[model samples]
Target: MTRQLRRPPETQDLSRESPTVSVVLLSYNRPDYLRQAVASIRAQSYRSIELIVVDNPSPSSAEIAETVAAQGNVRLIRSSVNSGYAGGMNRGIESAAGRYIYLTEDDIVLDKDCIRHLVEYAKERQSGGLVSPVMYNKTEGTIRCAGGEFALGAVYRRRTHGEGERDTGQFARPFNVTYIDGATMFARADLFRRLGGFREEYFMYVEAVEFCARALKAEQTLTVIPRARVYHFEPPADANASANF
Candidate 1:
């Protein structure tokens, strides 16, 4: 407790100071999912944001470009070569122009106030490197991942409480978490640049965990805001990626 209060103050600014955010969505061959994802961004209550969709080496990605063009503030980039997840995200971040940058998968659907809540939380913690919401499985309505814990050999992402479980009194508290799910994450642009972007080495698995380790090692906090919520489209029997882990 004393140690927490003794932490140094951060110098970064996180006000609604500006509503601009460059939201990046990286996709491969999932055009249908991309459409819904782009639409979710377009529907954000925070209107000053722009959308960047990176279509990585898909034969039909051009059609995604055409579809995104219909929306005024969207910028679509189709990569000639497949850069996988990390590379595609890097390309999108390079092109993003906003004080804050957000990343999400093409299958997510955001609530209108999603960005609003994230921005507000970030503002409260000026040096926060990453912030995310409590995510529920879109299909099952079960909690997916709220935040994570780094211990032993790997980080563990915790899911929701079991049915009929009583709400604890700690529900209102906002605390530092080990890492946020990359499915929906927000960060200040400068902090992101300082972190050197997501590591492209791991390809898919453990990217967020690695990034969180780096951020926490630097004394930057990763927070979870319960008020900000989203639904993750994880199919019931969807198994974790094998080789990526």
Candidate 2:
């Protein structure tokens, strides 16, 4: 999951059909990172995607609005309150108009082909639903996780693989994962609506996991597409929310 080029993709052919892909980028107070996230989406090779920036209401709401205004085709939704990641994403999902909904943090910088590859892979799957890409730590240039897992019994330690490894293709092959990092997730819009989006009660942490848990109950598959990649930058001290860290 390191942020280096892992050989050129054999095909740049994004998707046979250009279905609208909506990206719900959640940002609380990090304006600079928000701009980077929006710009990265705008720079994507796939042109059919729409960007929905859900800004948790804060003192910097006006500044965030101004920054999002500069980016064409991106819709800015200002929350009346700082309704955590769960609420923000639910609102964004409501506004999304794509066949696929991609969840991302404001601190992430996606590869140009990230959306393209994701949509292509989604169309390729027979019954897959939630899918995510390999997340690389921006500055450290190391693996964050191929996908996430949880240990049973006492601690229930949440684990992610290839934490500090180089981009050597050790965990390169695509596989089914327990949970995908909330930083970047792509799924079908129909399935998301059917699943009722993220539970607004959880607020931030464990919301995605809870959503995936329900998906499992419904017998849906969560997958990882190794070819799709994204750069997850270091987050603010508070982890997106004002004081949720």
Candidate 3:
């Protein structure tokens, strides 16, 4: 059910005076992971924040709704059909009422200061159109993506920086990047809305790549803030599934 749960007592007095960060968390069938992700967002150090959970017609929709209702302070958007990553996120983005929008997946567990650090960096780097935190594998304790770049050739290819590398202060500094991973993206609300959000035609994969490409074409900078961190609990690849490429 699409509904806005009552705000928690602590946030009842949240006013529009401060810049608000709207976190658009997309949930598929991973209800357990969604719970963890919501908890982490609730624990964020950034006080001016709103959590919008978009359920993309998961089989476990009832359970997902139950989990969100338990929070009693989040906005949940339930889609009738599974619209994939881009479409689901776009729904949440449309309902966002913040100055900044953060898009993340259910499998992500963010650090308490992740949003705070991202906002700080974005404020300092006003040119940044998209900013993201360094992501590490929750299980293996290795870098998943610090930032990423597109290696366009015969076909489009994505190269994630520091993927599978042990995090040992290598990507410790913030720097410019071609694109921020879709797992976690912090963007100015105006720019994201102006770009019409992600292209729904991509459905799931490569949507972030195309969106970043468009942003770059507009001369906007994309960056990765290393001080902010998130752990990605990526599911194992399907061995039986065929690779078309």
Candidate 2, residue 18: how far the Cα is off, in Å = 0.7
Candidate 2 worst ten-residue window by lDDT: 1-10
**In model 1, which residue pairs have backbone atoms overlapping below 3 Å?**
none
Query: lDDT tens string, model 2, 131-212?
Result: 9889888888887767877532312346776776798988666788777777788887777777777777676677777777
* All candidates: CA RMSD (Å): 7.2, 8.1, 5.7
Tens digits of lDDT, candidate 3, 1-245: 12222222333223444579999998877788889999999999898988999988755789999999999889999998877888888888778877788999888899999999988877776644889899989999999998888853311687789999998898768898886888788987777777778777777667888888878888888889899999988553221111210
Tens digits of lDDT, candidate 1, 89-152: 7777777767788888776778788888888777766745688776767777666677767752
Candidate 1: lDDT of 136?
A: 68
Which candidate model has the greater TM-score, 1 or 2? Answer: 2
lDDT of 2 at 13: 24
lDDT of 2 at 83: 70
Candidate 1 — what's its lDDT?
Answer: 0.69
